[model samples]
Target: MATLDESERYRILSDERRRLVLEILAERTTGIGLDDLAQAVTTRQTTGTDVGPGTVDRVRIALHHKHLPMLDESGVLSYESEVRQVEQPRVASERHA
Candidate 1:
């Protein structure tokens, strides 16, 4: 596992989207499909607003190309790009515990 200093941890959690991703992952025991995760995030982001498919698509793309990979690299979560799955690592889970 990669060790994250305080600054690195703060940097990773600084983004609202990344924080949301971790929150969603915390509720699940298994990996989530990228599409499902993206939808969930979009729903949360635009709770009372009417979000279109395009908005969801944008969030999906961001997660796939940016957020997921960053979190994966930081050892905060396990993101399988090819399979498009996201799950919190045991270390991350334990931190929540």
Candidate 2:
């Protein structure tokens, strides 16, 4: 796997959704459910907008199709596709510590 430098980490973290995901992951000791993560993202994203099940669904889709994979590939998080669990990588957790 390729190493992510500071700039790349910043780029990956630039998206609000991705940043939220990382923040949520960082707070949890165990893997978080994807649905719970999506809800948390939706809660933050819907502050001044029309929020609905559709909004949650859209976030879920984006997380599954785009964000999660990118995070997994970047060594930021370990995404268990079958179980839909998101966990922080040891290196990432160490950095946070």
List clashing residue pairs in candidate 1.
Answer: none
| Candidate 1 accuracy as lDDT | 0.92
Model 1 Cα lDDT, one tens digit per residue, 58-93: 999999999999999888888999999987676646
What C-alpha root-mean-square deviation, in Å, does candidate 2 show against the real structure?
4.3
| Candidate 2 lowest-lDDT run of ten | 87-96
Give lDDT for model 2. 0.86
Candidate 2 segments whose C-alpha is farther than 4 A from its true place: 1-3, 48-50, 91-97
Candidate 1 backbone clash number? 0
Query: Where does model 1 exceed 4 Å of error?
Result: 90-97
Q: lDDT tens string, model 2, 25-60?
A: 878898888898898889887788877888899999
State each model's CA lDDT, in order.
0.92, 0.86
